[model samples]
Structures are given as structure tokens and as C-alpha cells.
Target: MTISKDSPDVSVIEDRRLSCGVRLLVESNPSVKSAAISWWVPTGTMDDPDGDDADGLAVLCAGMLERGAGGLDSREFNDGLDRLGVIRNISVHDTSTRLSASLRNEELPSTLELLADMVLDPLMPEDGLDPVRSLCLQSIQGLVDQPPELASIRLNHLALPAPFNRSAYGSSQALESATIEDVRTAWRTRCLPEGSIIALAGGIDFDVAADILERRLSEWSGGSKEMPESRPRIGGDEHVEQSGSQVHVEMAFDAPPLCSSDELPFLVATRILGGGSSSRLFDHVREQQGLCYDVHAGYLRRRSGSLCTIGAGTTPERVSRTIESIYEEIDRFGSGGITQDEFDNVMVGLKTRLMMHGESMAARAAAIAADFHDRGTPRTLSQVAREIDELSHRAVDDLVRSHFNSKWASGVARVAVGPSTPFQPRS
Candidate 1:
């Protein structure tokens, strides 16, 4: 494991073609007292094929992986993890499924072994099917229960077509009909090696950890598949239905993706706009004018294009005023742009926050994997810091002009989730 000149503070060790074509990485955070092991399989919601039942299957497989593995039943697995003092958890996202655990240095080996077994082998019992399917359905239902969450999902549905915008968590009650064969097929295809990225970070020595993983994971093998690239499609009518006391207004417009160099400015501009209570939206809509309870702006970075969003909540009487003010702020930044103070403050906040994220070994490992996945090289913290430092007032203005300009930023998809009659935008 050689440290790149770019990021000496972090050491990345990668093992490719170990049996299952799995890619294992170890990112050492020497200063941290604990370590985290993350198993990333590139099978996410985007990988789901309609009628193939792959999405629900992958999710169910992830759920049952920890129920029992390697001669350890649920009780044994639970007891061993507890005794070892490990924080074991797993999640399946839009792009990948992950199993992660954090533990003290002394307990790393056993925990790693346990995690490996859980990933490599699982006893998916027939009785276990109902609960796992129910849970997945319940989660989908929960999202629908929250108007804001549901609104976001609907927005995604409008933003991207088919598998691209499809719910990673799968649809409601549909999982109830998913068969054992469906999950088996999903596990077979989605959990392949070439798309996998395994990352570890912690207090232990990189060589020893790598050796442990290398010896254990050397037998895994799977064929590599080219990941599909899809673009974000944003079209359709903007609707604001009345559902509650205050009107929840949400808007989304197409923008560039994460891989773009322009992402930095997008980040900076969004922070200055409505990242926190001190932002333009917060100050203008909630502070000075007192027209709304909250206001913020953000960009949802996807594989193809991203979505720039600005949202707010206000009384029926104030909704129109709030939207007007929000739009005004967007126009203001698009034209006059941000001052040096605004840019610097946001950068300072962002840089400080980025550094803070490095405090955790898990974060460091994931960061390395994510950077490597996107750009094929992980950037050093100093380089990133320097990049932020070098961004000038002129540069920010240029960025806004290039990307946030009204013409470049197409169609605003707005949704109002509240019970205030049909929402009509203020002219």
C-alpha cells in the first residue's frame, strides 16, 4: 500500500481479482481510535429490471445476511457482536448495497471475519421471507406517509424515467409478491465482483488488515458487467396540492452531475443561497420578511444531470410571497452573484465541514472509494482545501453565469404539498 503524493494523510490499499472479482480497499486513519469495515456491492435500485424482481431480491438478501452465517445463528451472531463491541449495520441504496461495522482495534479481526461470512454466506429461511418483505413494504409506506418525502419521490419520478428514477427501496406491497427465486436471481447478478468496492479504515496497521482481508476474501469471484449510464429527464407539470396547514413548496431544475468540474461552484452557490439559517433564503424569507418557516436550496447529484432545488414552507396567505422572494434570491445570485464575504464564508464553512468528516475512519474509507469510483483517483485533503482556497469572487460569478443562468438551467419542477386548495404560482 503506497501513499499517493496527493493524499499522504490517507493510505489506500486495493486488492483486485481475489476469487470473486471483488475489489477490497483499506484506508488507514492512523489517528482514529476505532476502525470501520465497509463492503460495497454496486447493485443498487438503478440495477433493477422491471419484472425481473431484482431490486426487491437484493434488498431481502441484504436483510437476511446477518440472520445467520458461518455456524452462527441469530443469537450467536448477536452475542458475538455485542461481546466484541461492534456497531454492525447494513443499507441498500440507489447505487449499491453496503454492510458496515465499526469496532475497536482489538476486535477488528473477529468482526471482519463475521462480516465476511455474512456477505459470503447467508441462510435465507422461508419463514424469514414474510418479515423482511413486510419491513421493506412498511418502509415504502412510511415514505408515502410523509408528504415531503413522498413529494421528493414523485419529483424523482418526474425527473428521471424508468430504472433511472425508479425507487431504490422498491414500490409498496410489490415486495409481498416477490418469491425466493426473485431474491436469488438478484443476488446472483447484482452482487458480482467487478462492481464491488470494499473499504476499511481504522486504528490498525494497513498491511495486517489487508493481509487478513486478502487471505479471507481471496476466494470470491464474479464476472464484471459494464454499469449502465442514464440521463436525468426533467419534464412535466408543477403542482402544489393542499394537504396541511402550511404550504410545502418544492422546485427542481436540471443541472450537471457530480463528475462535472462545475460541481464545486454549485456547492458553494447552494450554501450561500439556503444551506443554513444564515443563507439568503433563510434571511430573506424567514428572517427579514417572516414569510415562511424554512427555506433552502440544494442540488441532487445523479449519474447524468443533477437537480437544483429550492423549497420553503409558509401559511396559505404567505406561500405566494415566499415563492416570490425565493425566486428573487435565485435571480439575484444568477445576475449580481455573491460577494466575496458570502463566498468565503461558505467555503470556510464547507472546508471546515469537509475536514470534520475525515475524523471517522468509515468516512475516510468511503470518501476514498467514492472519489476513486468517480474520478479514478482520490484527491488529497490539502488539494481539496487548496481548490476551495483558490476559488475567487470572479470565479464564482463566472460559475453562476455558466451553470445557474436561467436558460442553461431548464424547466423548474415545483410541487406544493399542503391543504390550501390548488396552488397557483404568483405572477
Candidate 2:
């Protein structure tokens, strides 16, 4: 599975499938002495069984993996990696769980074995369960004091359907009631090789990496189960009243999915709206009107469906004005579209980001894995840059009109966390 070289500077991408069903993607760069690896499986929060007590099982499962594996205690396992100078991270998303690490290229073999053990032979000890469960519950409880995070969570609950709406931290009730057996069951059911991908970037030979992975994971086998799908529930207002001087408001609108043709256009539109300090939202709402402490909009690219979210932190006294101002900017953007100058600037910015990611092995490894998971094919940095360059101003403008015109008002999901909900219905 050799992918043709797409760019002069980019190495050829090698995609392979092991007998056990684990997919391997490697981008070898002989110029560097370090390697970054990303192990991805379809064991995300969405895989948790439908029950209040199961909300955070996926997260708990990931945590338990780090506790011990292959008969080694947590301390011994971590010390082994430390001796190899490995930096490891594990995160569970809505649709996937990613285990990643960066280490010297020479330590690849040992690192691979350790990672395989964590995934395939996790101990999930009964004693470890209570501590991790308590941590997860505390994380959910900690959200109460974080207005912005609370608002984002509430927005997702209101905008997305069940399971897909489940948070990475799960809920307090779920964590409290979840037993060790429940987490073990969820892990066995969801963590399979068929839907998993292992990505390696930086200084490593593709053949060597593939061989290492095959030897480590070939005996591990499990069938992958499909996650339940649901459409987003857009256009509604939800308010969680809290005692605070500042109000946190989050607005979400439907956008193109990862598989849609309009994905790039929507991403460009998000940047123009609020990608950075120079974006319309920041320039208008914060810099000009001085209504918000901070404001930004981002395009969340998801396999189920994409979303454009705008969030603002502002005084309760100014929440209404801040929301109205955001709406005004959206309307203006929909009607006016973006200018050629803005297009060029955004294109440059996007390319700059792509180039920077090219320099980081970790970023490249994670990117290829995510691309394969989301699109079934890995993309080169050059491919992404070309796509961004090809996007015309007119096409973006058209997308903005279609997704953010008067339709934005009708299709928006609003969540406010504060002492009062000051926003009124759009007439």
C-alpha cells in the first residue's frame, strides 16, 4: 500500500494492514532521529452503553489502561517508558481513543511493545478502579466552576443527540455508579483492532515499523462494532443559571462533515469569522465594541457532522449586547462574504499551520491517524495546502450564505451559563 509521493518535500505514505486487522500508516523521514507514534481505536465515549452509570466508562477504561498492563504495576510500566525517554499521552474523544508517544527512533521496538501491552493486556485492577473513578467524577464536578467549559458541555448536550453528546469526562452520576466490571466490559467490547490504526512519523523505516507492529499486535484480534449514529439537534436555547459576574455563552451551527466537499470551505469561513485575533468576531466584539473578555469561533470537523461554534466570555451586563453583536457580524459576513485580500491572508495562515505541523513528528503522526480514521486515507501536507489554495473567495462566500445567512439564526443552538440569560429570541 504505497501512496505516491504527493509533494517533493513530503515522503511517501505507506499504509498496511496486519493479519490481526490493525492498520499501519508510516511517514519515514530520515532527517530526524526521533519518532512519533499514534495508536487510534474506535473506542471513544460514544461507545459507552446507553445508561446513566455508563456515561464515562470509555474515559475510565483509558485511564485504567495506564494503571498497569502485561502483569506490570503502574509504577513499573511508567518507569520502563521513562528509561526509554518516551513521552506518552492518552485522550478519548467522542468517536475515538488516541494513545500517542514520542521517543528516540532507536527505542521504537520497546516502545511499540509497551504500547501494545497497554492496549491488549491492561490489568484493570479492582483497586485502581476506585481512584480513577473518583478522578473522573471530580473532573465532572470541577466543570461547575468553569463557566466556559460548562457552557460548551451544555451546548453539546442541547445540539447533539445522545451518545454523540456524551462528554469525554462523562458525568458524576455515571462515574459514581460505574463498577470495575462495567469498565472492563466496555473495554473488551469497544477496543478492537479491526477499526484501529497505528501511525508512525519521523525517523523510522516503514518496513521496520510495520514489522514491529505486526509482531506485537498480530495475535490480538477482535471484531469492531459500529457506533450508533444520530443527527444533530440544532436551533434551540438553553440556559444554566449560576452565580457569577461573567456570563458564558456558546453558540453552535451545523456545518459540513469531514466527508463533505464543503469541509474546507467551512474551515476557511470559520477562520475569517474568528480564527484569530484579526478575525471578525475578535475585531468587532472584543476590540471594537469591548463587550467580550474573549471570543472566538472554530470549525469542529467530525465524522458524524461538523459544527461551527462561537463562544464568548463577558460580563452579565453585556451578554445581551455581545450576543447581538455576534449575530450582526454573522449576518454581515453572510451577506458580504469575504474579500480577495481576506482570502489570500487566510490561505497563507492555513498553509503556515500546515508547514509547521510538517516539522513536528507528533503532529504528523496524529494527523495521519486521524485522516485515515475519518477519511480512510491519509493526506499529505501538500495535498491540504493545494486544497486550501484552490478554494476561491466566491466559493467560500457562497458557503457562508448557505450555512450562516438567515439560516444561522434559525439553526443556532445557544447555551448560556451565568446568573441570567439575557439573549432574546431572534425576530
Candidate 3:
């Protein structure tokens, strides 16, 4: 295993041809006694609309894959995992589907082989289809039952351009329409060598894990790498309705990509405005006014731009006042920015958190993969800290003013999910 001097704290081995064109990253962390193995395939809901089944296909494939594999039924496989003391699970996000497990170092080889087998050779049983479809449908229905989650999903739909405006989890309509063949086809196409990343992090040796993966995956390999697909950006159509108890508002504007240098100041500006409980929004909306139960804001990302949002759960009666307060803070920060003390504190807080994140090998591996996906290499903690340290209130304020302007703000959308009226900003 070779680790660059850039991130000496973690050793990373990148295997480009572990299978077909699938890439593998093996990271060693001596601090933890367990191993975390993660497989990231570029088949998230975002890829779904392009294919026949769209996002639902990847999800169904994930569900059916786990039902049986490697001469074991779901329960039998799960029991074997339990006997091996392995913790296994899977999840699908907007951009990828992930299968992960953590186990004692002693079971690393068996776990790796089993995982490879499952990813490539699932039974995709016909009888398994209806239950998986029912489960996905229920999950979507359940999202409507939770206020915060429903509000957030609606906010994203309003904020981002289509088809990402759709749920990260496929919509009920799409999931219901998905066929078994569509699910299987999506797996065959998207989970190719080039678009997939396998990451193993923790106490195990790299050579041992690599050999196990190579052998199990070699015969199954015959595909080429895939270039990642492009998704929509932040700006889009806007919609709002009066139908909830608390006003759920989310405003997104275009900002620099994660790889851009401007990201430092932009992040700082966002933090000072609404990054945490101590931020301006919380201070004004919650502490001083007593109008809102929750109010703090943060950012989201894309390859092209980012989003800064302020959300709160407040009465329809107070929604106007609350949004005004939020805008007031935005204007104040844009005009004068924050003080050096404020900037220093936020920078320190964020840096401290980043440092703490390094303690986990799983975090390290995920970070490395995301960085490689975005910027080709991970930024060292010191590099990130230095960028934060050099930030001036003026620079960040400019960023806020540039990206968080009204032209963009008016495009801000709201998705209220209770008994409140539509919130209208004061002129």
C-alpha cells in the first residue's frame, strides 16, 4: 500500500483494474480493530430517469441483490454474516448505491469474497419483486408522514433543476412502474468497472484484501469503464403554496463548485449567516424573537454550483416576520460581512470538526473517494485550515452578496407541509 505525503495520516492504495474497470481503494488505519468495506456504484436515482426504470431500477436491484447470493438465501447469508460477526447494510443516495459492512479483521477475506459475489451474481428472483416494490412504495408514503423530511424533499424539488428535483429515493410513481428487467438492466449498465469504487478501510492489510477481491472479481470481469453523467444545476422554476403550520422555506443560489478556490470564502460566509446555532439566523429568529422553533441554515453542493438555505418551523402567522429576519441577516452580512473574531471562531469550529472526522478509517476512505471524484486528490487538513485562516470578512461578504442576491433569492422555493399559509416576503 502506498500513501502520498499529502495525506500521511492515512495510507491509500488505488487499484484501477480490480474488476472489469472497477476501481478499488484500500486504506489502512491501525487505530481501529475493525474493517469497513464499502462499494460505491454510480447508479443513484439521478441516473434513473435516463434509463427505462430511472432511479427505481437501481434501488430494486439493490433490494433483490441482498435477497440471495453465493448459494445462500437472504436469511442464510445474514446468518453467515452474523456468525462471522459482520455488520452488513446497503443504501442508495442521489448519485450512488452503496453496500457496506464492518467486521473483525479476522473475517476480512470471507467478507470481501461474499460481497463481490453478491454485487455480481444476485438471483433477482421473480417472487422477490412484489415485496420490494411494496416496501419502496410504503417508504415513499411514509415520507409524507414526517414533516421535516417531506419539507426538505419538497424544498429540493423546488430548488434544483429537474430531474434531481425528483426524490433521491425514487418517487412512488416511478418505483411502481419499474419492472424487474429494468432493474436488472440498470445494474448491468451503471455498475460497470469505470463508474464503481470499492473502498476498504481499517486494520486489515491491503495485500490480503486486494488478493481476495482480485480473485473473486476476475472471472466476473468483462466490461469497460463509464464516464460519469451530468445532472442539472441549482436555478430553476419556483413554486409555493399556503398549506402548512410552519413555513418551510429553502432558497438556493449558484456558487462555485467544491473544487473552486472561492469555496473557502463562500463556506465561511454561509457559516456566519446560518451555519450553526450560534449563527446570525438562530440568534435573530429563535433567541431574540421567539417566533420560530428551529432556524439555522447551511449549504449543498453540485459539480457546477452550490446552494445556501435557511429553513424554519414557525407558525403561518409569524412566517413573514421570520423570513424578513433571515433576509435582514443576509443583507447585513452582504453589506458589512462578519468580524475577525466571528470568522476566526467559525474557522476554528469547522477545522476542529474536520480533524475529528479523520479518526475514523471509514471517514477517511469515503473522503478520499469523494475527493478523487471531485478534485482528483483530497485536501490535507492543514491546507483546508490555512484557507480558512486566510479568509477575510470582506471576501466572504462579497461571496454572499454575489451568490445570495435577490435575483437568485426570488427564485427561492418553499415546500410547507402542515396547516400554514403561503409565506410572502415584505416589500
Local accuracy by lDDT, each model: 0.70, 0.85, 0.68
Please list the residue runs of candidate 1 whose C-alpha ends up more than 4 Å from where it truly belongs after superposition: 1-19, 51-55, 229-234, 238-242, 405-412, 420-427
The digit string of per-residue lDDT tens for model 3 on 18-119 reads: 655667777677777887877887667666665323557767777887877787777876677788998877887766778878788778898887788688
Candidate 1 lDDT by residue in tens digits, 1-427: 2222244454445444355566666656667689887778788777766543444655677777767777778678778889999987788766778777778987888887887777666666667677888888888767635766766766776666546666656755457777877776667666766767777777867667767777777776777777567654555645646455767777788766786777787778888888998898899789999998888888787664477887776788788788777767777768877888888788778777767766767776677667766666665556566677666777777877665555443355667677663345434
- Per-residue lDDT for 164 in model 3? 51
TM for candidate 1 is: 0.88
TM-score for every candidate vs. truth?
0.88, 0.95, 0.87
Q: Please give, for residues 1-427, the per-residue lDDT of candidate 2 as tens digits.
A: 1121245545678988898998899989899999999998877988777764568788899889999898899999999999999999999988889999999999998999999999999988999999998888788879889989988888887777766877788877777888899988888878888989899999998887788888888888777677687754545898898996889999888778887888888888899999889898999999999999999998877776667899999998898899889989988888888888877788888777787888899999999998998898998876776677677888988888777765565555889999988767657
- By lDDT, the better pick of 1 and 2 is 2
Off by over 4 Å in 2: 1-10, 51-53, 231-235, 425-427
Best by TM-score: 2
Which structure is stronger by TM-score: 1 or 2?
Answer: 2
